[model samples]
Structure formats: C-alpha cells, structure tokens
Target chain A: MEVVLMDILGAVVTFLVAFVVGMTYGGLSRKITARVQNRKGPPFYQNFIDAFKLGSKKSAIHHGVMHHFGPAFLMVSSVMTLMIVPVLTHNQWFPNLNFQGDLIFLLYVMTFGPLGMALGAGQTGNPNSAIGVTRGLSQMVGFEIPWVLALVALMIQYHTTSITGLMAAQAHSGTWLMFSSPFAFVAAVMAMFGMFRYSPFDIVGAPTELASGPISENGGKYLFVMMSSGSVFTFAKLTLYVDLFMGGADNLLILLIKTFALYLIPVLYGVTTPRYRTEQAVRWFWGWPSFFGLLAILQAVFF
Target chain B: MMNDKNSQKIVDIIQNWARKHSIWVLAYGTGCGAIEIPPTMTSRYDAERLGVRGAATPRQADVLLITGYLTVKTMKRVIRVYEQMQDPKYVIGFGSCTINGGMYYDSYNTIKVLDKYLPVDVYINGCMPRPEAVLSGFAQLQKRIAEGRANGAQQYKDNLEWYRANQKKIIPNWIMPDYNW
Candidate 1:
C-alpha cells in the first residue's frame, strides 16, 4: 500500500513538473519567435492564461463520442510517456516506471495519441481535419525512419534496448553517448525537427492553409486538455532526448538545463526557416536524416 | 455554496480575467480593410503582446472582427461564422464600412447597420483603420471582456429570433442549422 501511494505521489509530482516546464518552454518559444520577427511578445506565462481561459469556457460542442475522447486519449498518452521517462538520475521522489525494452514501448506510445486524434478528427466530418491527419501521419512516417535507425544504432552499440540501460552505459563510459556516437546523435537531432513539428515541418496544422488542421473543430475544454497534454508531451520528449544523448542529469536544475539546451535546437531552427509542403518535408526527412541514420548504423556495426 | 451568487461572481471574475488576457480574433476580412491585419499582427503593432492573436477558425476564436463593408452576400456567411463560434464570443465592427457601409452606404447590396443582424461589442471608426486603430480596437474589446460586459454571444442567443428575422430579410433562402445553443 505504501509503495503504491508513494508511486502515485511521485507520478503526480512528475506530471506537475513536466506541465510547468513544458508550458514555460512553449511561452519562451513564442517570445523567441516574436523577438526574431522584431515584435514584442506576450509574457512567458501567457500560455497558462490561455489554458485557464480555454478550461473556463462555458460550452463545448462535439460531433460524436470519439470527438470527446480525442483529447482524453492525447492526455493519457502524454502522461504515460512522462511516467516511462526518468526525470532525474537518482531521485526517489520521481519514481517513474522504467524497465528493460522500454525504448521500444516509448516509440509505440508516442504515436498512439495521434492515431486516436485522427479517429476523433475524422468524426468531425471536416475535410481539412482529414487532410491534416493524413499529412501528419505521412510526416510521422517520414521522420520515424531516421528516428528508429538512430535508436537502433544506439541500442546495438550499447548492447541494451532499455533507456535506463543506455543511460547507465553513458555513466559507465564517463562520456555522453552523443560524443561517442556522434552520427546517431546527428541523425536523432535531425529527426527531432520533424518530431517537434515547428515551422518548415508544420504543414500538418498550417493555420492559414488547413484552418489549424486536426484541432480546427475542437475548442473550449477540449482545446484546454489538448494544450496541456501537448505541454506534458513536449517535456517528456525533450527529457527522453536528454537522457539518451547527454548523460541523464543528476539533479532538477541540471535536468532542466540539459533538456532546454536540446529543445533550443529544433525551436531556433524552426524560427528562421519557412514552411515546407508535405511532400517536400517528407522527402527532406528521407534524404539527409536517413543517410545520417545509415551512417550511424554502419559506425555502430564497425566499432 | 456552489450555487451561491457570491461564489458565482468570484468564478466570473476569474473567468473574465483569463478571457481578457487572451483574445483570439477570427478576422472575417470582407473588404479592403484586410490589408491592415498583417502589419498589426507582425512587426509594426504586434497585437500578440496584448494577447490578441489570430484564430484560424470560428471554433477557436473569441472575437469575430468584421473588417470593412459587409455586402448582403457576405453578411450571410458572416452570420454563419458568428453562430458557429462558441459561447462568450465578441464581435468588433471595424471601419466606417461596417458601421454604415462607408462609401458603399448608398450602394445596393451593402449592409448599413451591422448591429441589426449581429450583436457588436465595439466599433472602430475609420475609412480603413490602421494597425494602431486595430490595436486600440482590440484594447477596447479586452477592457469590455475584463468588465464581463462583452456578452455579445449571450445577446445573440437571447434575441436569436429577431437577429434571424433581420438576417433572413436579407438572405431570402436561409439554409442553416438551427441555433443549437
């Protein structure tokens, strides 16, 4: 009973931390984008206000039962991903579920939310949502090749399929895997661009073109849930990358620093770039990123 | 305690505060006034600093900005868009065109009075309002939101029949979903 209660408490705390950090990062990205464009931006806490306002909205309409479950499914996936990723190197309070072969599970879990969302968007009877979902799924397929190859290369090189095992390998070696497996890191970071879905790769939900895509029909509380889930998911993905590439952080501050540094790579890149069409984006991903992934795999096999 | 008037007032206060800070505008650019929106949203005025961002659809929008003159044909679509928006929505009638049709007032097919068909929360008067005027208009909407007085959606609901009558007078063949809310 005590163990269960502790775990529950740990999960709640982990979620709260992820939520705050993720929302702040989103706000900071907006600020950075604003500054880049030579404009004054909203405060760093603006996203929080938007979330609160969305939640407080009096009415929400849904096309069907699936529409209602869409955000819930997204929330579940994000929280589940957060639970599987370790936040700190040796923290008792943040007792998350880490296990052997969890890396494979993580990949499956991350994509689960989008498929659920696609189901809901389809039920809305909106052509734009359908187009957006197809584009998003195709883009997912584009990025997944390099992402999987990078992970596979790391797993083969380190002789472990678990995220914790990979982290342990880095700790044992006294150097980050990013330094040891530079090609894998390069491939992974390149794939991260599409995964983050910032500009250039943001065709899936191109606001002007697709009417905000899959989320076009969702508003009020539904939007609120989606927004919060997105924040949690962002933090989780960033933490996963930090754990894999950088030696997993020993403390909260270090973890935040490492994750934010990794996060800036996609965000800064997105700000300066223009949007790419779905086909162009897919081809771009299959081109150089896949090549790097192949090189990573070859290097791992030889070394 | 949940139903207590004071408690509800407190909830309203909090909600109003949140709503005031985030005004997602769905600019229904019906006329040449659409030209000013880019500058307002981009480098010059930066309406985002005041939480006045552009929403892609009616579902996600809080404010329906009716920019420039609305013809009889466009008004039908505008009405449809306004009704599609969720509750607690505001409408800003922009420019002299929306107020009394501007130079198109004498011209046939242009709407002279916007409030006859839709409840407008604020009206910014100009031949074509500049980015500064648009920012000011957003500020006015924000102030009304904070005061909990921008209940244009509620007013529309309460007077749905009258608004519909006015709308139908212009749109002879009214083919629309019933105001479900």
Candidate 2:
C-alpha cells in the first residue's frame, strides 16, 4: 500500500513539473518568436493565463461522444508517456515506471493521442478537420521512418531496448550518446523538427489555410484539455530525447538546461523558415533525415 | 463559512480577469478597414503584447471585429459567424463604416445602424482607423470586460427576437440553426 501511494505521489509530482516546465517553454518560444519579428510579446506566463481562461470557458457544443472524449484521450496518452519516460536518473521521488522494453512502448504511446484526435475530428463533420487529420498523419509517417530508424540504431549499438539501460550505458561509457553515436543523434534531432510541429512542419494546424485544422471545432474546455496535454507531451518528448542523447540529468536544473538547449534546435530553425506544403514536408523528411538515419544504422552495424 | 454566493463571486472575478487579458479577435473584414489589421497584428503595432491575437474560426474567438461597411449580403454571414461563436463574446464596430456605413451611408445595400442588428461593445470612429486606433479599441473592450459589462453575447441572447426580426428583414431567406444556447 505504501509503495502504491508513493508511486502515485511520484507520478503526480512528475506531471506537475513537466506541465510547468513545458508551459514556460511554450511561453518563451512565443516571446522569442515575437522578439525575432521585432515585436514586444506577451508575458512569459501568457500560456498559463490562456489555459486558465480556456478551462473556465463554458463548452456548449460537442458533435458527439467522441468529440468530448478527444481531449481526455490526449491527456491519457501524454500522462502515460510521462510515466514511462523517467524524469530524473536514480531518484526515489521521480521513479516513474522505468522498465525493460519501455522505449518500444514509448514510441507506440506517443502516437496514440493523434489517432484519437483523428477520430474526434472526423466526427465533427468538417472537411477542413478531415484534411488536417490526413496531413498530420502523413507528416507523422514522414518523420517516423527516420525517427524509428534512429532509435533502432541506438538500441543496436547499446544492446538494450530500454531507456534506462541506454542511460546506464552512457553513464558507464562516460560520454553522452550525442558524442558517441553522433549520426543517430543528428537524425533524431532532424526528426524532432517535425515532432515539435513548428512553422515549416505546422501544416496540420495551418491557421491561414486550414482555419486551425483539427482543432477548428474544439473550443472552451475541450481546447483547454488539449493545450495542457500538448504541454505535458512536449516535456515528455524533450525528456525522452535528453535521456537518449544527453545521458539524462542528475538534477532538475541540469535536466531543464539540456532539454531547453535541445528544444532551441526546432524553435530557432522554424522562425527563419517558411511553411512547406504537405508533400514537400514529407519529401524533405524522407530525403536528408532518412539518409542520416540510414547512415546511423550503418555506423551502428560497423562499430 | 464560505457560502455558495461568495464562491461564485470569487469565480466571476477570476474569469473576468482572464477574459480581459486574452482577447482573441475574429476579424470579419467586411470592408476596406480590413487593411489596417495586418499592421496592427504585425511588427509596427503588435497587439499580441496586449493579449490581443487573431483567432482563425468563430469557435475559438472571443471578439468579433466587424471592420468597415457591412452590406446586406455580408450581414447575413456576419450574423451567422456571430451566432456560431461561444458565449461571453464581444463585437467591435470598427471604423465609421461599421458605425453608420461611412461613405456608403447612402448606399442601398449597406447597414446604417449596426447596433440594431447585433450588440456591439465598442465603436472606433474613423474613415479607416489606424493600427493605434485599433489597439485603443481593443483596450476599450478589455476595460469593459474587466468591469464585467461586456455582456454583448448575453444581450443578443436575451433580445434574440428583436435582433432576428431585424436580421430577417434584410436577409430574404432565413435558414439557420436555432439559437439554442
């Protein structure tokens, strides 16, 4: 009973930390984007205000049961992913379900939210929603090839399918995987551009073109849940990358620094770039990122 | 003991503050006044600093900015958009055009009085308000929101029949979803 209670408390703490960090990162990105464009942006806590306002809104319309459940589904996926991906290394308070073969499970759990969103968007009977869902799924397919390949390369090189095992390998070797397996890190970071869904790869929710796409019909509380879930998912994905490449962090501050450093790759890149069409984005992913993934696999096989 | 009424008042205070800060405007660019919006949102003005941002759809919007003169044909669409928006929404009558049709005052198709058709929270009087004026207009709306007096959506709901009657007179074919909310 004590073990179960402690685990529950740990999970809650992990989620709260992830939520706060991720929301702050989101706000900072907005501020950075504004400064880049020569404009004074909203406060760093703007996202928090938006989330609170959204939650307080009265959601009067929902197309169906699926529509109502969409955000809940997303929340579940993100929280589940957060649980599987260990936040801190060798910490008693943050030990969140780090087991063998969890890396494989993580990949599957990450994509689960979008499929659920697709169903919810489909039920809205909006053509734009349908188009956005298809575009998002296609983009997912585009990035997954290189992403999965990079993970497979890491697994092969380290001889372990678990995230904790890989982290242990880095600790034992005294060099981050980013240094040792540079090719895989490069490929994965490239794939991270699409995963983060920044400007060039943000066709899924193309506001100018698709009227905000899959989330067009969702507002009020539904939007609130989706936004919060997105923040949580962002932190989980960033933490996963840190654990895989940067050898994981020993403390909260170090974890944040590494994750934020990794995060800048996509945000800064997106700012200078223009939006790519669906096919163009897919091809771009398949081109260089996939090639890097192949190179990473080859390097793993050879050395 | 904290009673239900006190708790409700506390909730209302927090909600009003949030609504005041984050104003998502769905710009219904009905006339030439639409030209000013790009500058207002972009580098020169930067309405985002004031928590005033553009929303893509009616569902996500909080303020409906009716920019310029609304013709009979466009009013129908405008009303449809307004009705589609969730409650606690505000409408800004942008420019002299929206206030009283501007240069198109004598034009046959243009709406002379926007308030007769829909509840408007703020009116910016200019041939075409500059980005500064637009920001000022948003600030005015924000002030109204903070005072809990921006009840345009509620007024529209309460006086639905009068608004509907006015709307139907201009629009020949009245086929729309009932205002159930």
Point out where model 2 deviates above 4 Å. Answer: B1-3
- Residues B1-181 of candidate 1: C-alpha lDDT, one tens digit per residue: 9999999999999999999999899999878998999999998889899988899989989989998899999888998898788888999998998788789989989999999999999999998888889888888888898888888888888998898899899999888887677
Question: What clash pairs does model 1 have?
Answer: none
lDDT per residue for candidate 1 within A157-219, as digits (tens), equals 988999999999999999999999999999999999998899989998999999999999998
Q: List the residue pairs that clash in candidate 2.
A: none
lDDT (CA) per prediction:
0.92, 0.92
Task: Give the alpha carbon lDDT tens digit for every residue of B71-126 in model 2.
Answer: 99989899989888887789999999877778998999899999999999999989
Looking at model 2, residue B145 earns an lDDT score of: 88
Error of 2 at A129 (Å): 0.7
CAPRI-style class, candidate 1: high
Interface RMSDs of the predictions, in order, are: 0.9, 0.7
The clash tally of candidate 2 reads 0
Over A1-303, each residue of candidate 2 has an lDDT whose tens digit, in order, gives 999998888888898998999999999999999999999998989998888888887778869999887788899999999999989988878868868899999889989999999999999998889999999999999999999999999999989999999999999999999999998999999999999999899999999999999999998788889999999999999999999999999999999999999989999999989999999999999999999999999999998
Model 1 DockQ, alpha carbons vs. true complex:
0.84
